[model samples]
Target: MASFAVLLRAVNIGPGLRVSSADLRGAADDAGLADARTLLNSGNLVVTPGSSGAGSAADVARLVEERLAERVGQDVSAVGLSAEQLDAIAAANPFPAAARDDPSHLQVHVPFGDLDEAGIARLDLASPGREMLATAAGVLYVHYVDGIGRSKLTPKVIDRAVGAPTTARNWNTITKLRAACAGLASR
Candidate 1:
């Protein structure tokens, strides 16, 4: 079976939609994914299923939405990734030096799509402490020297940029996810 890293979006950020890691693992297990492991509270899951090579990402996303709705009482959005995809995410880290040790720098992973120049320019991200729009391999890498919570480029900007949906993780979380994918591949 191939290794898969599922990045769940818009989960338990505040007090309202709280989903514990153990509960997330249980949901994955119930969905028939094997050896499911959760990385952190922000909904990063690494699972090895019996037929990981079988299903499409849309299928996985559907399964997660259905199960999480039942288990956590909320429909969660998930993005699935193979080992290779996760490796590419690691390699595609634009601000690698800043990402290594800085707590504020983050990587926003968006799917491959054609974002129009007009739409891209409409993003009013003139913040001083943050560097926006580092496009590499179809992924937008946003590095925030200041904390994301304080940044002006909120989730609304991201949603408009991809024109679909996007999820982000801090530099440390991205690094850990990459390492977990690598370890799973080695095994």
Candidate 2:
């Protein structure tokens, strides 16, 4: 079975679904994903596909949604990315200096599906405030010099701009996920 990184959207935020990482791990294990592991609380999970014919991103997303909704008592949707995909995203980061110097300042909003160009063009890239870098891999690398809270480029804004369901994670989380993927690959 191949290793997959599953990113759940709109979970553990505000007053929404509050499933803990530990509980999520149990839920994933119960859902038949081998050696399920979670990082932090933003719903980043690394799992091995357990079924005989299951490794696709769409398959993993369906499995997570089905099991997590039953186990956590709420609708939880996810997007699956392979270990190599995660590593490629890390390597394609446009603002490496910003990520290295100020990880908190550099953030990424990744779509669970293909991003349409017409939707992405809605973003005002020429705006004087924040900077957004789009890669061919469909990940947006953003840097807000004044911090995320102070910037207008929210997750909602990105979702609107890209017109795709997405989840946001900081540079630190991205790097850690890459490392986690590497660790899983070695196993």
Candidate 3:
């Protein structure tokens, strides 16, 4: 079985949507995933399933969407990452030191096929105290000198820049997710 890290988009945050980490694990289990675990309430999941192909990601996403939509009567979406890919993301981290002290630094994971120079240039990321821009790997890496909660660039802003579906985790969370994936693979 291949291991994957899945991030649900725009769910369990403010407003009416409320999905617990236990709910996420239960969804994975219902979808036939093995060794399912959740990182936090923000919808990060580490699951080992029989496959790691994008097709499998799509299936997990569709199942989760269907289940959540049934529960909340609203649509939801998800993005999945292979353990290898997550490891690559961790290795590709450019501002590890900055991220260590500053929880505002984040690694935004964008679909590899959805990145373009023109879209990135249109982000208008010139705000002071927060550095936000699209990276070569299609991920928008950001460092908010002030807390990200106070930063002008929200997750929506980053998504608009990439012009596609995206999910983000702080640098520390990314590293921990990477380790979890790696450990799962070793077993």
User: Largest lDDT belongs to which candidate?
Assistant: 2
Q: How do the residues 50-104 of candidate 1 rate in per-residue lDDT, one tens digit apiece?
A: 4433365455555655677799777777877777766776687767777666745
Question: Which candidate has the highest TM-score of all?
Answer: 2
Error of 1 at 123 (Å): 2.5
lDDT of 3 by residue, 1-187 (tens): 4677887877776785777887787777667677778887888888777432324655556666666566556666777778777766666766676767775466555552466556656654455545655465446666666667787777666666667767777777887777887777778
In model 1, the worst 10-residue window by lDDT is 112-121
Q: Would you list the C-alpha lDDT of every candidate in the order shown?
A: 0.69, 0.78, 0.68
lDDT string, candidate 2, 25-130, tens digits: 8777777777788999989998878752456756766787788888888888788888888878887887878988999878788886677666666676545565
Against the true structure, candidate 1 reaches a TM-score of 0.83
Models 1 onward score TM values of 0.83, 0.90, 0.82
Q: How far is 165's C-alpha from truth in model 2 (Å)?
A: 1.9
Evaluated against the true structure, the overall lDDT of model 2 is 0.78
Backbone clashes in model 2, listed as residue pairs = none
Superposed model 2: Cα runs more than 4 Å off: 126-128
